[model samples]
Target: MGIEWAEPGSSGHVLEASMRPVDSLQHSRATPVRARMWKFSLPLRHPETGRLFADIDHLGAGLQRRSIDRYMWLIHDRDEGSAPHVQGALRLSNSRTSTQLSSILGLPSTALRPLRDRSGQHGAFERYCRYLLHESPEAQADGKFHYPDSAVHANFRFRDMIDRYFGLADSGCVPTAESADQIRLKVYNGDMTPLEVHGRHPMIFIRNHKSIEELYYKGRHDRLIAAALAERAALKDEDARVPSTDPHAA
Candidate 1:
């Protein structure tokens, strides 16, 4: 499940009304109830400037790490005839705690602020939210973007190393064999590039990269090769102990 940032209801200024006895209109036996409506604007503006604010990337990251739901306002635009609109408007620049926003805006505990004006486009905030939750880390680390083609080549080499170390058909690991075969076929046929493979199988790619780094980073290939041989033998023994359900099983 994912986080739900918006709520359902009518949009724009939320009107809260209450009724109390009218003092002037009260008689001993007859009293009139006076209804009063308070229009509370959504605190979708900068507290100091009362202007629309948007710092999408920061807000996205902050939302993931922070628990200040009270501090954040739902971005909304009101249509006179429609239900309250809460969709893609950007949030305030400051990702402060709800208490802070409330204190700064002098807002009542029950009121919420929606963005008075939109930041030109809808869905941008949503996209940013997704990106922050998913791709922002890799993007920040210069993992995928920096290498461009290097990661693909690196992944290909890693797959080749694994296949060489533990022969696909001989190895007891069926899933690993299937994944390796897919990589081999794609790399050889030019149907998939290294980067594309990484995208499809990121966990495998990262694990392979780390494995390769352990093996070759300090020029310890012979030791790693010996370890792989021992692992392969162990797998072969494990495979032999299991009764073959299929006569064709390797």
Candidate 2:
């Protein structure tokens, strides 16, 4: 048997096959499974009123009922003229075929892209979690910090899900509150490494691209910095040679 549902702005039909209840799949210990990670952007919030367009809890519950392995999500506030939206990552379990996964999620197969790390340095899921939690240096430099308590509606559930899925035993690495000036001092004085700074303050880090670049390739940061300086000098010389745009100027 199959069930069909229509989604707004979707032209193709969606069919979900009747499968065995997902509850039967749960066990005392979560089995090692081939997990697929996905990122989704949903129009499930109001831009102006800061209201949710749909019941987020209900949506999460539905996903849980459908046997999703784990997820972490947040409602992003409108920024720089963009509308507010819900952004999230989904980890699907049970080794279901991609087609079945698409059917379960009620999304077109084309839209269900599995996240992967192109650089092969880290797992896509881990990198994405770091990005979303503002743990990555890039995210820290971007200055768009997302606090789990304020940004995520189901923060507790998300934490529990992550801990369970990763088998993480809390190391008591809670961040201590620090003023901006204090953070700046700690980061700039070479008192601590980038990872150490991140451990203490996951949401804020002074832009230290060199430290990040050094992690992957020792001494590459200096070469890249020199190359950038050369490029800037060349651009300045090019600009100097250009004819003046002002008609009244000498």
Among these predicted structures, which one has the highest lDDT? 2
Backbone clashes in model 1, listed as residue pairs: 10-84, 11-84, 42-113, 42-114, 43-113, 70-98, 71-98, 152-194
Worst 10 residues of 2 by lDDT: 1-10
Worst 10 residues of 1 by lDDT: 146-155
> Per-residue CA lDDT of candidate 2, range 1-250, in tens?
1222223223323333333234324421344333367765444433334444444555566466446767677765533333444556667665444355554555333233466667744456655654555534455566655444356643235443333322222233443444434544544554555677556544343333344324424334555887899999999999999999998998
TM-score of 2: 0.41
lDDT of 1 by residue, 78-119 (tens): 332323322222244444333343343344323433332236
| TM-score per candidate, chains pooled | 0.19, 0.41
**True-vs-predicted CA distance for residue 208, candidate 2, Å:** 14
TM-score of 1: 0.19
> Which pairs of residues clash in candidate 2, taking residues 3 or more apart in a chain or in different chains?
none
